[model samples]
Target: MNNKPVGRAPNFTNACIVMFGVNITWVLVVIWSLWGLLAAVFLGLGVNHLIERGRVWAAARQAASIRRGKRF
Candidate 1:
């Protein structure tokens, strides 16, 4: 029986890790000082941008790999 998993699991894992790291950093910033709230807001926005870009990159890479007849 074939046991290989399907789809972009690595990309999902990377995205989740990035999101978790961003949230933890934000929490730490909030705990550090009230002044850090602004920084946290910007950080959150940056993280969102990064996640979107990463997904796009991953999808493109996956498609290329598929076209090459290989698993990503």
Candidate 2:
């Protein structure tokens, strides 16, 4: 088998963006007493993290299946 790399690079860029958003959200919502928006931001972050993990898991599974010459 060839030594081609599998999958894409690490998701540090998105992580950084998410962290920046959280910081800004915390600053604005805390000062303005907008607790609802803060909660929404955290919930959205949770969903985003889940989706990212799911994509990575799916890609890993697909890569493994490809290596084994089976249908993913």
Candidate 3:
């Protein structure tokens, strides 16, 4: 039996794509106004931070489930 944990590569890829898209939109906004650019940067960073935190939380939850021998 293959007993390895599932990797989070797909989740990481999705996170990167989402962040990249947000940054691109922010760049466009920057061309419209300085304040918009600042807001985009701040919001983008905050969102990305939240996503990372969620990822960590999910991973921990999965690990706990595995320890309990619970299958999803």
Please identify which of the two predictions, 1 or 2, would achieve the higher TM-score against the true structure: 1
On a 0 to 100 scale, what is the lDDT of residue 12 in model 1? 85
Q: Flag clash pairs in model 2.
A: none
* Model 1, runs deviating above 4 Å: 1-28, 31-34
Please tell me which predicted candidate would have the highest TM-score against the true structure: 1
Task: Give lDDT per model, in order.
Answer: 0.82, 0.81, 0.80
1-72 per-residue lDDT for model 3 (tens digits): 999999865458788889988987867587548666667778678878999999999999999999999964
Q: Name the weakest run of 10 consecutive residues (lDDT summed) in model 3.
A: 28-37
Order candidates by lDDT, high to low. 1, 2, 3
Q: Candidate 2, residues 1-72: lDDT per residue as tens digits?
A: 989889887869888989988986676667456566667677667767998999999999999999999998
lDDT top scorer:
1
Better of 1 and 3 by lDDT: 1
Q: RMSD in Å for candidate 3, one decimal?
A: 8.9
Q: Tell me how far the alpha carbon of residue 25 in candidate 3 is from the true structure, in angstroms, after superposition.
A: 2.2
Of candidates 3 and 2, the better by TM-score: 3
Clashing pairs in 3: none
